[model samples]
Target: MANDKTSMQLVANGILKENPIFRLALSMCPAVGISTTVMNGFMLGIAVLFVQVCSSVTISMVKNLIHPRIRIPTYTLTIATWVTVIDMVLAAYLPEAYAKMGIFVKLIVAFAIITMRLEMFACKEPVGASFWDGLGMGLGFMIGMMTIGLVRELLGSGAILGYDVLGFKPLLFFILPCAGFFVVGLMMAFFNYIEVFYKRKKGFTS
Candidate 1:
């Protein structure tokens, strides 16, 4: 039977309790590297989502077939296959975004987020639960990346998703790689405080 709490719990964990980039800080490479523009960040998130969902499902479905000693290699192979497909699709259709994203698309193969979820959750859980967990985690990742990208785009380019929002002059430094970390950190702290405040309001102990 599917665990009713699994999906909800996964959502809460990924969005609030254990965000991949914000809280757990697992996939920093893509999160910090390709998030200068909102479009790039969003596309990166979708790619990671694809990799996560496909890999989790593949691993969960075959959990019992692979020997314990060789499970990691098997899982990596599965994830790599999906990543390659995504890379090719992006390169073919979204060449501009692909060029902007640079090697981060290829780095999806090494994003620790996919492997961590496979090892920590998918390998041990049923397919349904694993799928939900992957979905939730992927959404959280998207949120984290978008949050940083939004701030950076607003400040650095005076725009949002390439559309000009604020008329303020651009701050060149906000587009730098170092600024990605700062923006992400501030957003993480903001989410953390919101989580804490919500728990306190609900009379839940941390």
Candidate 2:
């Protein structure tokens, strides 16, 4: 049915076309805050992905139960529950990365991307479609964060995922907070450039 196709398209668009960080430009705080290394970025990505998917599902399921006047509080409760679980699980098994990520882990509860998707898309869609949308959006965020971490590690630290690519001194400044903004900006611009060229070659409008 056309409706099903539209749902699928919405899901796909969330993941690739309207990525929370790269495309929609949401949740850059966590993206840049926790991506100091590959492991850190990977953990942060997984945590955020989990939080986003779980919160969306929960909110979707309870969408009709909450009154419109208090929907925001209900959504916050749903998000908080999942984020707490993620935090506890990571702290128990992955203490090192947990320590490295620090307060950023706790901050996931307030990530506007997850909340936005839950309210705007998930609450209005079927469970399956909401799930896919969450998956796509989460993966998009993961990809963007990992890309930033990869660049920062390679350029600022001369490694990818902590493995030495070249025996050269790194630019320590790139590992700093300011460099996160700089690297993310350049990387986004690069992605845009590539997308533009691809669209031109295909003669398709994005």
Candidate 3:
């Protein structure tokens, strides 16, 4: 029972408290670069989810064998291996989405968010905890990217996932790189406000 509770907390922390893009401000590059549409964001998120979980589990299984001095390189190599596999599989099977995200899929190997988790949590924890941590973080990243993509796509193109909703673009800027910053910042603030409100309501001071 205690283990289950701990796992739930780890997952919740990744999704709500330590979100890679929104809360922790990690991996902002992909968050901004690929979030032009909901599908784009979601696809990248799926890749990250798989890579993160696989890398975490792999690292946990071999943490004891990895030398402390070379763990960073080991982690990078492990992550790269998974990223390459996913990239190839996507190219061979799902050519359409792969065409749109091939380059971005390769970039996940270097994402600070994934690396940081391996170094900070996965390597030091048991396999079960690390897996949950990765899952939570991956899910959080997906949610963050999807939210930004949905908002930007809807407002900038007047559509959601390429479906026209408003008949006209409301703000073309929302689709641009500059708008990515604005959307992320605003969403970050929105989540911060919610946290503050909840804390206050519960009589907690932070």
Q: Best-fitting candidate, measured by lDDT?
A: 3
Q: By the lDDT metric, which is better: model 2 or model 3?
A: 3
- Where does the lowest 10-residue lDDT sum fall in candidate 1? 1-10
Candidate 2 C-alpha lDDT tens digits along 1-206: 11364557766787678888888898989777767677777789899889988888787787788899998888888889998999999999989888889999889889889889988888887777788788878877788788778888888889888888967747888889877888888888999999899999999977
Candidate 1 lDDT, 61-163, residue by residue in tens: 9998999999888988998899999999999999998898988888889888889999998988899888889998988898888877888888988998888
lDDT of 1: 0.86
RMSD of 1: 2.4
- CA lDDT, candidate 2, residue 134: 86
Q: lDDT tens digits, residues 149-194, model 3?
A: 9999998999988889999999999998778888888887898899
* C-alpha lDDT values of all predictions: 0.86, 0.83, 0.91
Q: Which stretches of candidate 2 lie over 4 Å from their true place?
A: 1-3, 6-11, 199-206
**How would you order the candidates by TM-score, starting with the best?**
3, 2, 1
TM-score per prediction, in order, is 0.89, 0.90, 0.90
